[model samples]
Target: MKSIKFNRELCDFCGTCVGVCPHDAIELLESDLRITDKCTLCMNCVYICPVRALEELDEG
Candidate 1:
């Protein structure tokens, strides 16, 4: 399966990723961004995030 990884250092908690992810895989945790579900690896969040915090990882 594919996955999404967030660069915590780059994330500004702007919530831009969460809004772009159609799978609802992103969320806010204690003011920080978090991945709440398995990513479809569509790269939508990665491309939409202004901070460029999200990444796609192949787990095959």
Candidate 2:
């Protein structure tokens, strides 16, 4: 299965991913980005992430 992966080291806490999530599956913490279970595998956050912090994880 393909899912979203968040890299805390790469994330700048910019909240850009949060805004782009159609399902509101992304959360911006003080230092972390959270991908919620509300995610429908849309991959919108993956494509819109400017810093490449979010990516498509092929867990197959």
Candidate 3:
């Protein structure tokens, strides 16, 4: 199993993740992103990242 990994370098801050999130877990600022605890690891944001920024990482 894997958890969501945020890559600040790869993120374009396009708000794509914020839009795709069903739980409204992702909040996009002018130059930063805020992910709240409401996230359920649903991967909605991860899958919608056009720049390949968001992804799930393996703990092992």
* Superposed model 3: Cα runs more than 4 Å off: none
lDDT digits (tens) for residues 1-60 of candidate 1: 677777889888887777877888777786567676565666888889887777777788
lDDT of each: 0.77, 0.84, 0.83
In candidate 3, the residue pairs with backbone N, CA or C atoms under 3 Å apart (3 or more residues apart, or in different chains) clash, namely none
Distance (Å) between predicted and true CA of 14, model 2?
1.0
- The candidate 1 region of ten consecutive residues with least summed lDDT is 31-40
What is candidate 3's lDDT per residue for 1-60, written digit by digit as tens? 667877889888888789889999987877777778898888888888999888888887
Off by over 4 Å in 1: none
Error of 3 at 50 (Å): 0.5
Which is the leading candidate under lDDT?
Answer: 2
| Selected candidate, larger lDDT, 2 vs 3 | 2
Number of the top candidate by TM-score?
A: 2
